[model samples]
Target chain A: MRQTREFANPPVVLGYATIAGPKEGEGPLAAYFDKVINNLYYYEDTWEKAEQKMFLEVAEMALQKASVKKEEVDFFLAGDLLNQIISANFAAKSLGIPFFGLYNACATFYEGLILGAMLIAGGFAKKVLVGVSSHYATVERQYRNPTEQGVQKTPTSQWTVTGAAAVVLGDGEGKIKIPRVTVGKALDYDMFDPSDMGGAMVPAAFDTLLVHFKETGLVYDYYDLMLTGDLARFGQQILVKLLQENNINFGQRLNDCGIMIYRPEQQVNAGGSGTACSALVTAGYVFNELSQGKIHKFLGIGTGALLSQVTTQQGMAIPVIAHAVAFESY
Target chain B: MAIDKNEYQKTVEKIKPRPPVLKNCVLAFLMGGFVCFLGEVLFHFLRGYGLSEKDSYTVVSVVFILISAVLTGTGIYDDLVRIFGAGLIVPITGFANSMVSPALEHKQEGLVLGVGAKLFTVAGPVVIYGILSSLIVAIILRGLGKL
Candidate 1:
């Protein structure tokens, strides 16, 4: 196994697609998404089923954009925040692709990208598709109270992003390349509050980012942008402070997908989260920048707080992880 | 890894968003008072319509609970709760919402097992204690020759 942090044969990003629900579509980066369903249900009976439909749709859309047939793709690495990752499972079943379902909560998109890039980099697969999705209603019901419960959320509580995004990595020529990935370790700082996920996840994000910078020997200014998955406003603040303490700063360039995806007046508490948070932002906004030659190099770090309702109720600390994937526009 | 517990807690406290307790309390109080006022209006209206005082109170409570349940079903009560905070919850309407919301959410599992079984997941203890307390009060009243 190639245990190195940087990939020798960086995989090329052949094509990518992102789809979001109405709320996300209303966000500032809505125009970047390939498809934005006006309704959360999107013609499905249940929110879970709708999310599954979105996953399948975005997967197909990504493959179509790449001009690759479903059979041409060797593997589909996908995940979602749902229990048992049923959305990805059902989508995989419908797509009839060899599936590897992952669970890193909101950081699932980067996890999928890391694994998919590795599969392509190691010559295990010529073409691999990475997909991730999260529906606000589905995740809200699963993690917290029911949507209809009328439970008042705290200011720190983030809105779960409702969307799906997919990226196809292949050996062929592409506009962008993923050269390195830094997988994060699970770090639990004894933060037991499930509501303040951004606070819980900052330490893990800092640890992974520190490791990435050390391994790559790259400075903060090397990349034009350093993006975290779903740290939102509070997580971004904590991350900045943590990095400053370590004497590594990426001022102004260190933005978060959670804070970028939504408008301030959208009232999304601490901005957006869910697997779709980074997925949509990266595949839509970041990919658009890379394609438009606006950004030369970028580091996308996906952060996730691996906490469940049961774990939280049992008084267990929330363990957080962050995986970083380096991309360059060529 | 050996994380400094004190340092971690300090960082968390520094960065974590503090809940606006005063604002929440004010909103909760106003909303809770409004709900009660609405109940009072209904109670008076019922009593004026020839219903006994006890019957009018019961009718008012039933109407509020019904409204709350419907609001919960239509996904409007949650919006109200978001703005009102504990205001909607402290009232009997909040109790009604609590009962109906979980049942509605679990309705996909089928009627008997999903809705019926998990119906009282939140309100079950309240019902049991409510009945027990009421029974004990009744017994005490009878023993004191006040029943």
Candidate 2:
């Protein structure tokens, strides 16, 4: 038997990471570990440095938990939502580990994990870490206008998640396993509704879910949970309806991390978007739940839309796509 | 590929020099001012249409963007932006200009995948955050008895 468990060497995901805007009340450096991270790191000369410092802090947290030196790790996999992956690239440069740059818009976490787990499972490396970071100001300027002033948005817009996160993956003691990974099928709606990306991703989510069910020869109840990335209230309901319409009732088990992470009414209209939205939730909430044996098998779905005004100016419409991965606790 | 200096010089000489004192400057200033004044008037007019001042500004931005996008597509706004830089960029016009430029720049990508998709590139994050955070913050306040 393959010893079907929750995760193969279920890397007990320890350590949480984040970098918040002024609205997050305090900077990441001001967290409880300020003395170790140093608040002055925020006073660095450039935003790029600031973001890299944030990632390093998160990575160090995972390293501390693992009780392993940075050099002991075989490779480092990181990414961000910048044009050149500056933070991740720089973090890799500073950390002096082999690097892999990733960009899936906000779906970077799942993508990073999928790659990281593959590397470890294929015996390419023993221990590895995967993470993604995004800042509101950095991503906003790249995708939109500068934040020197407030701008208006359409109903389809999604709030960007203002944080960074890192998680450790290893066959350490008391850890879980990560054996089977069913890469998700992508659904691109081309809806052009930035505010409502969840709606755009619904078709893809359903497609991936149904395909997973079909291929695995598993029914709706096969997994204990199904989670979607950043599909706040509006998108969540639309996804539920779409799935139910296809006779795949997700039931209460289908929880959206974007909707669930932040408390209600902070004005994350539809919910948060960014690579960290799902990554952090996966680390903080899902990992906790899975480790506690509260849930064995789960599905994670991340969605992103493929459209920008520059593309639109060329007479293009939005084509939204969603990628979903299924995980089982061994 | 080396440049032909003589041909380039001839081309440069063929280009007519712009007026030392801008005639278009005065016209752009007057027209841009008139448009902005109309926006203020429309702001109040929209209030009469059952919109709050905030809502009116929102409507104004949308209208301004629509008109500006059309004008930009026709290459008129670029002229206006050059002539009356700050004048055109103020209030709703400036906002509209910001919204349209990115779309125009990226229009070469295609409709479903490019133009339609990226219309929000400049404005998408704001709308996304505005809508999402509004809900999240509202819920938080309600939970805390602040709302």
Candidate 3:
């Protein structure tokens, strides 16, 4: 090892992620809605609160696993899909730690972690906590009408997840080391559709990931897993087809976080969106595997669509951005 | 699974739109009114903090801006907007709230280049028109020697 003071030998992933709502097969929320005359009137409302709760719970879980108290953490960095970070604010109020709230729409998970690692590596802080939260209801209310009920989702629509995930970082913990980060340029197709955020963001994702590969002189085969947040089957197909056209084959390692989160039996017409979709899956599924040392290198990419209701109302097109962070167990 | 003509017509008849329910109207009124009440309460609290009415309004504006900026930066505002829908945004505060957020969001792109220039994104048109109208009004008043 070069120096314990500089970097952890293995860069251990000490923490995990969590979700508040029951899995589709478990039937908790759907059952509650069924009891209310098969109406899901409060799903959004309930999901919003539960989403924040899960973020905090997940953060606590990770902190506990790392054996670090809330006070010992140097900074709390997080983001969400809400206009004013309601979940993060409430969570921070309870955690009572210094925090820097960030937003990159859906891409915030990677953005938060990358910034957290940067702060740690730069000696701004020894131990940094990075996390993000998302809810289904909170998103619909912001982008659509409040009083409208039971609007059928389009095939392109991705179901939002009510969850959050946090990861703790320090000087040397013998876990995964965050190696590199690539920032993407924002690309707006002027297409106002919100149901297909992945389509809007694919260009940015391709651009950034390709640029990272080129600049670092790395090949697509170098990373074992390359993932994108919220892009479901259709979007993933699009990403794959596009990359293949570009002669950049990501192989089977390329996957979408949204597609992985949904169970086939759930009848989720498309897949999942929302900040939590990426956060929890990465925390629960991806991090779980990472901790087991099954995967050594991963490139986590998050996509965010920059669409405000006012912009849509004013007939402005939705622009999207994507960011990526590379990770490896040293 | 082709349907008979008569059955298709009957199904279409059954799918006819119904009138708005009294309960829906009542729920909308109560929820919308409650949000207004909260706004008024916040305004009054700010007023009680020893500021003039105009100053309080400005303070409210600043508070709303900072709140949205911080929330947008932290990724919380998106959740609030998602759940509350227009319930939180349709009020007067929504306009200014939307304006400052994107500015703060792109601050890292370049504070001088991004934040300063893009801060007026949502409110830019309103501010420009407001100044133009005020200038026209002032010119009219001066021509009439009413200053």
The model with the greatest DockQ is 1
C-alpha positional error of residue A289 in candidate 1 after TM-score superposition, expressed in Å:
0.7
> What 10-residue stretch in candidate 2 chain B is worst by lDDT?
B8-17
Compute the interface RMSD for each candidate structure: 1.7, 20.7, 13.9
How much RMSD separates candidate 1 from the native structure?
2.2
**What lDDT score goes with residue A9 in model 3?**
35
Docking class of 1: medium
Please, what is the whole-model Cα lDDT of each candidate in the order they appear?
0.89, 0.63, 0.66
- Alpha-carbon RMSD, each predicted model: 2.2, 19.5, 15.6
List, residue by residue over A140-162, the lDDT tens digit for candidate 3. 65666321221334456667765
> Candidate 1: where is the Cα deviation over 4 Å?
A1-4, B1-3, B132-147
Best by lDDT: 1
True contacts kept of each: 0.81, 0.00, 0.00
Worst 10 residues of 3 chain A by lDDT: A32-41
Residue runs of model 2 more than 4 Å from their true location after superposition:
A1-41, A44-46, A185-187, A306-309, A319-321, A326-330, B1-147
Model 2 has an lDDT value of 0.63
TM-score of chain A of 1: 0.98
How well docked is model 3, in DockQ terms? 0.02
